[model samples]
Target: MQDGNTNTPEVETETATDWLTQLKNVIIEYAPAVIAALVILIVGLFVINMVVKLAKRVMEKRGLDATLQKFLGNLLSWTLKILLFVIVASKLGVETTSFAAVIGAAGLAIGLALQGSLSNFAGGVLIMIFKPFKIGDLIEAQGVTGVVKEIQIFTTQLNTPGNKLAIIPNGSLSNGNIINYSAEGILRVDHVIGVSYDADIKQTKEVLMQVMQANDKVLKDPAPTVNVSELADSSVNFAVRPWSTTANYWDVYFKVLEDAKIALDAAGIEIPYPHSVEIHKGE
Candidate 1:
């Protein structure tokens, strides 16, 4: 029994030595491939970065939309990286055909999960193509009104009149109605000024016209108009319409109103306020 057990240990030791030799042989045979894969990975990553940078510069030089430029850059970088990884894996004896199949399956699953994100991306593409509105356009949509600050793949940034920043999803923005106040180069400002019925209608109209004309910001070709719009119990209302450049719309609007009030007052026109008469009777 002692002799048999001693021989068993010897056999076991020989088997262990043989396994180590096989492992060493395998490493020696594949060492060059492993090193090559590492080199390729490192160099490929550097090249991918360079290519992406070049693409970004070209897009910027072409004056592409900032949002589209960024999206394309990211997409290009990711595609190049994936291709490089597959090549490196193939160098190391990985079956890239099967790897590509796995990647395709994963992509499908991810796409299905991100349906909403895909919709927004599609909407952004549509917005870029059609271009109903662009940066710096004062637009009203989705129950919010603001100047377009930036457009992105998923959302749009707006600077509201109150200086608030609003982030709206591109999906809704593309689908909904957009009223671009700045689309037309000019805007018509409408105002109604009321004066006492005793005031001269002709004189009030003339005074309003003078106020509008005095503002150089107001356009002269279209010609501003002041006409009797309504007759109320206390006053006659004159509709004062003036056309001005969109940039100066608000300035012209407020200045014209202020000047009209001043002009009317100077002309001795009375702006009547509501009043009630009280009567006392014996009970």
Candidate 2:
């Protein structure tokens, strides 16, 4: 080998040294940022938890509705965490604008896939803001009549008269008609009673009025009214309207119906029924 071959080995050694120096420089420049990102991540999570807890306490003290409290707390937590994520990403040298664009696109995709769920969420928000119906309120909505058991973020729970639990989407429930029976604290129980046309109209009215008045549950202020509404082909129809507290509505309704029949029988007022007649097959 020629003595000049020593120059080639020297050049190779220098090249290897330069590559290691650049790698070391890169590590030195980024090591602090990596460490800082970790610290922020851990501390940020702890702070987020504390904030959520404090918010819940505040909401409870304010006497906010329980369902609303939970929803607000969750929303606050998610929003804060998203902000923290952006901070952490930026600290680690990620471009904040580009990251946000990616997140936005992903969110758009998810939203498109969950249209109904989003609608229900919006509906729930509207329900909470409007205060249409509360727990234990007897209401009719979406063609189902029941007591409101719960108002959730996406749905409403109803305990039906047949003791069935009905979960209705908030979207439809909010858009549909809702009859809040207990809103005014009082309800009018309407009854259309038919008696034999033979019975005197004045006597029928008196008898029905007495049935409502005798019941302690029926309200006296609004005053019950009995009027002859119509005279059908077979009998005279009386509109028996009784006012009662919402809680006692059903009790008054059922009791009056039974008592009216008893009172009518005592007064010898006839409730007509058709009779059957038969003819011999052969003479």
Best by the lDDT measure: 2
Model 1 lDDT tens row, 1-283: 3554555878899999999999999999999999999999999999999999999999999888887788888989999998999999999999999999999999999999998888888888888767888999999999999999998888889999899999988898899999999998788999988999999888888889999999999999689998999998778999999999878988999999999889989999998988889998989
Candidate 2's C-alpha runs over 4 A off are 1-27, 277-283
Q: How do the residues 65-117 of candidate 2 rate in per-residue lDDT, one tens digit apiece? A: 88998899999999999999899999999999999999999999999999999
Worst 10 residues of 1 by lDDT: 1-10
Q: Which residue ranges in model 1 land beyond 4 Å of their true spot? A: 1-16, 32-36, 91-98, 128-130, 196-198, 230-236, 277-282
How far in Å is the alpha carbon of 157 misplaced in model 2?
1.0
Count of clashes, each model:
0, 0
Tell how far residue 142 is off in model 2, in angstroms. 1.0
